[model samples]
Target: MFVPFLIMLREGLEAALIVSLIASYLKRTQRTQWFGAMWAGVFIAAGLCLALGIFINQTTGEFPQKQQELFEGIVAVIAVLILTYMVFWMRKVARNVKAELEDAVDQALQKGANSGWPLVLMVFLAVAREGLESVFFLLAAFTQDVGYAPPIGAMLGLATAVVLGALLYVGGVRLNLAKFFKWTSLFILFVAAGLAAGAIRAFHEAGLWNSFQAVAFDLSNVLSTQTVFGTLLEGILGYQEAPTVSEVAVYLIYLIPALLLFLMPARPAASATKDAREASSARR
Candidate 1:
């Protein structure tokens, strides 16, 4: 539940930031009349994401047990891959995101009053990317365990992000977004690792993976998965009382290198920080 909460928080914040930037640009340029187009794009993107997520969920539910495991395993792997790429991609591209978005807004507005397609398309694509990413991650998260907590957590996270975005836009609050993302990225890395392990376990259950079937360790006596605390750990951290060798191997392989790369310093990061701070200030 906590993992899903953070995932939604991060993804929702990204979408909110995009929409906030577009709205800020529109207001600053005295083009408030075109606000309808911006909102249309946001709604369309959100609706599409919701539809896609629901369709995926419903389709997977009709499968047989073995097929269900296979499908879940595949989706989990895809989610982890996408999550890992997303984290690194954001690290690489976040600095330029503000300027690029502003540039896109300028282009969209330059097209003028004859049609709102330019602005609408721009905002739709921007928001849709974040929305779809969230959908896939959430689907994988929901597949991991049986419960209502993850979805509830996700809803709360999104609501909080919307509020935060509003506060930022209204100049009611200031945040060091760079630091926030850095810390969150670290947490997300662990979450993705857990997801990967779960995927391996799922594959094993589906009979698609047989190697390394040996139990690396068993803690069921002390930490039974049926317990509330154990369930929480399993849901959030992919904790298994008796983890198979392959699961542990995959977890370590993904987390260690991913963390190393994520924590490594980038060249000339100070300038990027300056640009991000300037952009954040301008959004107000």
Candidate 2:
């Protein structure tokens, strides 16, 4: 439940922020007439995401047990890749996202042919990218746990994101986006590590991976995943009471390096700019 909630919250806010940035740019540029087309794109992209998610979820349920496990493993792997890419991509672009969006809007409107369509396409592509990422992630998360809690938590997270997005657009609230993303990025890495481990377990269950099948440790007696606190940990961090050796290896192999790289301080913009200027001077 907590896993889905946090994932959905982060994903939904990303999409919302993109939409708001585009909208804000359009309004500032006196392109309010294009608002209708922009909104059309958003709604269409959202509907497509919803429909696709439902279709995938419904169809996957009919597979045989082994095949189902294989499919889950495949989905989990894809979700982890997408989630990792998203975290780093946002980290790279968050500072310049507004400028990038404004430039995109300008290019869209400047196109001589079918200007409105370009803007619509731009908005659609941006939102759809985020939506698709969320869909794959939610599918992986839902497959791991059964019952209404995850779904309900996801919906609540999305609702909160929408309200927050609105507040931001209206200047009703202010947030330190840098800090927010930093904390959330750390949380997401933990989730992705768990998914990586879970994917290995799923592959083993599907009879695809057999090596290193030895149990890493047995904690079921002390901290069974079925218990309340254990369930919370399982949901949030992919805790397993008796994980296999391969699962433990995969978890640490992904998590440790990911954390080190993420925590390493990024090069300052001023330093980067100075280096670029030095290179240009040498070339001249």
Candidate 3:
């Protein structure tokens, strides 16, 4: 539950940031008359995302056990890839996101007078990217277990993001977005590692992997998934009582270099400071 909550919170906040930037830019430029189109784009993207999620869920619901496992494995792999790319992509663009959005709006408005399609297209593409990413993540999360907690956690996280976005927009709160994203990205790396390990397990269950089925070690006697804490860990970190040797290997192989690269300190601290200041100024 906590894992899904955090995932949704981060993704939702990213989308919120984009939308807030667009809205704020429009207001500052005295082009607020197109707010309706902005909202319409958002709603359309959201609706499409929801529909796609529902379709995928329903389509997979009727699969046989083996096919279900295969599907889960596929979704997990896709989630890991997407999450990894998102982490790196955001790290590269976090400093210039606001400026880029403002520029996009400027270009859109300049295309033609009384032309709102550009704005709509821009918002739709931006929001839809986040929405589609969230859908994949939520699907991967739901594949792990059967419970109501995941959905509840996702809803609460999204609500919190909306509230935080509103606070930021109204100047009621301030945040160091750089620090927030840095920590969350670290956490997400671990989560992705877990998903990768789980994907290997799912493939084994689907009978796609026959070798390396040897149990690395069994901890079922000490802490079974049936236990409360074990269940929570399993949900958040893909804890396995008797994980396969391959699973452990895959987890470490992906996590080690990824962590090192992600945590690598910037070469020039001065430039980082300048970028941070620029980001702050853009936010203002």
Best by lDDT: 3
Give the candidates in order of lDDT, highest first: 3, 2, 1
Report the lDDT of model 3 for residue 55.
99
Model 1 lDDT tens row, 1-284: 78888989999998888888778877886888889999999999999999999999998898999899998899888888878988987898677777777767766867855788898999999899888889889988898866898899999999999998998889898989899888998888888899999999889889999999999999999999999999888888888999999999999999999999988886555675566556645754
Scored by lDDT, model 1 comes in at 0.87
In the range 1-284, model 2's lDDT, one tens digit per residue, is 87788888888888888888888867776778899888988998999999999999999899999999999999999999999999888887776676667666776777825568888888889999989999999999999988999999999889888988888888898988888889999999999999999999999999999999999999999999999999898988899999999999999999999999898877554554455445433433
- The reply for model 3, stretches above 4 Å from the true place, is 266-284
Q: Please write out the lDDT profile of model 3 over residues 155-201, one tens digit for every residue.
A: 99999999998888878899999999999999999999999999999
Task: TM-score each candidate.
Answer: 0.91, 0.93, 0.92
Model 3 Cα shift for residue 255 (angstroms): 0.8
- Model 2 lowest lDDT segment of ten: 275-284
RMSD from true fold, candidate 1: 3.2
On the 0 to 100 scale, the lDDT of residue 159 in model 2 is 89
Q: All candidates' lDDT scores?
A: 0.87, 0.87, 0.88
Winner by TM-score: 2
RMSD of each: 3.2, 4.6, 3.2
Q: How many backbone clashes does candidate 3 have?
A: 0
